[model samples]
Target: MQRMLDGLIKFRQEDFEEHKALFSKLKRRQEPHTLFIACSDSRVMPEMITKSLPGELFVVRNIANIVPPYKEVHQDYVATTSAIEYAVKSLKVENIVVCGHSNCGGCASIYLPDEVLNNLPDTKKWLELAQNVKKRVMVHLEDETDEYQREWLTEQINILEQIKHLLTYPYIKEKYLNKELNIYGFYYMIETGEVFIFNYDTGVFELSN
Candidate 1:
């Protein structure tokens, strides 16, 4: 906490002062180009990963970076749906990137014991949205190596699933079909610092370099 506070102090004294004009303009309003959604994991820093500066990306971070299929029951769609609608309809972001990373603890949590999952009921339930993702990957790649490759495959599949879920939103569907917004699925490998983009044409993830 002290570190963060001190960093803010330094920003106010130095960085913010140096970029006063930029900050002054940003203080008025923001028009970001992309809506970047990723995990709340400490290791996943979207700005650093994408080499973006302040005000460049509008971001939403949640455990597993999951976006539930739009629903109104019990107002379950409150947070995720609101963010999606605002980003698309109001913010008017041109691109929406659903990024999933390697070695996601949320993905591995499914293998946890009952006791563990019982304590994380909400997380467990949210992750259940990816049940089809887990089933599809496990069955399709049963013969694949059980190492980084498999983990990467799972992460890639999760990103694809989230992208599909994004389109399920009525507003997103309309915008996407009208070519008003573009959706992308990205897999970021933490260890290797590589980003693989899911190619809609070939239905495969290829390193974006």
Candidate 2:
């Protein structure tokens, strides 16, 4: 807590002061270009990773970076969906990036035994949205015992799955079909500090260099 407080003071004294003009303008309104959806992992810092300034990327971070199918979204848990709706309909963000990172606990939690997942009731329920993702990953891992490969495949597949969920939204689908919106699946490697983009054409993740 002290670290955070000290950081706040430092920001006010240094960073914020240095960007006073930019902050002054953003104080009134924001015009972000992208809606960046990422996992609630401490290592996955969306703004720092993208080098985007304040008011540039409206970010949504949730366990697994999951987006429920439009019709399946529940009234009790509408945080992610509401953010998506507002960003698309009201904010009119031109781009939406669903970022999945390496060593994702939410992705791995999909394979957890029922007994273990029982303690994490909400997390378990949230992760159910990606159960199909586990099946897809398992099929690809046939006869392979490499956990690292399994991890890599799962993370990338999760990103693609979230992208699919995004399209399930009527407005997003309309904008996407009309070429008014662009959606991207990003896989970020924490160890390598590298990003891989899911190539819609190639149907595989490609290094974003």
Candidate 3:
């Protein structure tokens, strides 16, 4: 608590003052350019990683960075979907990034047995959105035994899945098809500070260097 308080003090005294003009401009309204959907993991700092300033990225973080399909958006309390909708339909963000990071506990949790998952109750239900992620990854996992590689592959595939989910929205799909909006799938390596971007045409996650 004290550490957070000290950080807040510094932000108000130093960082905020340095960007006071920008903050004043953003005080009334914000017009961020991108909608950044990413994991709720503490290590994945969207602003810091992208070197983005305030009013630059509208961010939504959730477990596994899951995006429920458009058909299910009608369901009650769909926070993630609602954020995506507002960003596209209201904010009119030009780019959407679904980012997943290395060693994500949420992605790994989906591989647990039903009993284990059920123990988590709400988490289990939320992760079921990614059940097919397990099935899709299992096919190519028969011969691979390295835990590290397996982890990254799952995280990368999870990013891809969420990107697909974003397109399920009619507005997003229409804008995407018309080339008015751009959606990206990003997989970050936390330890090495590396990022791989998904290539829609090549069907690969190429390094962002």
Winner by TM-score: 2
* lDDT (0 to 1) per candidate: 0.84, 0.92, 0.90
Q: Which 10 successive residues of model 1 have the least lDDT summed?
A: 71-80
Clashes within 3 Å, all models in order: 0, 0, 0
lDDT of 3 by residue, 1-209 (tens): 99999999999999999999999999989899999999999999999999999999999999999999888437468788889989998999999999999999999998789888878999998998998887778876755677776777788888888888878889999999999999999988899998899998999999997
Q: How close is candidate 2 to the true structure, as a TM-score?
A: 0.97
Model 1 scores a TM of: 0.91
Candidate maximizing lDDT? 2
Question: How well does candidate 3 score on lDDT at residue 158?
Answer: 86
**Runs with alpha carbons beyond 4 Å of true place in candidate 3:** none
**All candidates: CA RMSD (Å):** 1.9, 1.2, 1.2
TM-scores vs. true structure, each candidate: 0.91, 0.97, 0.96
* Model with the higher lDDT, candidate 1 or 3: 3
List, residue by residue over 1-209, the lDDT tens digit for candidate 2: 99999999999999999989999999878889999999999999998889988999999999989999898556686898999989988899999999999999999899899999999999998888999899999898965678888888988888988899999999999999999999999999899999989899999989997
In candidate 1, what are the lDDT values of residues 1-209, reduced to their tens digit? Answer: 99999999998999888878888889878888999999888999999999986788999888888888876554554676678778888889999999899889876675568788889888888888888788878877866657565676677778888998898788888989999999998888898999988899999988997
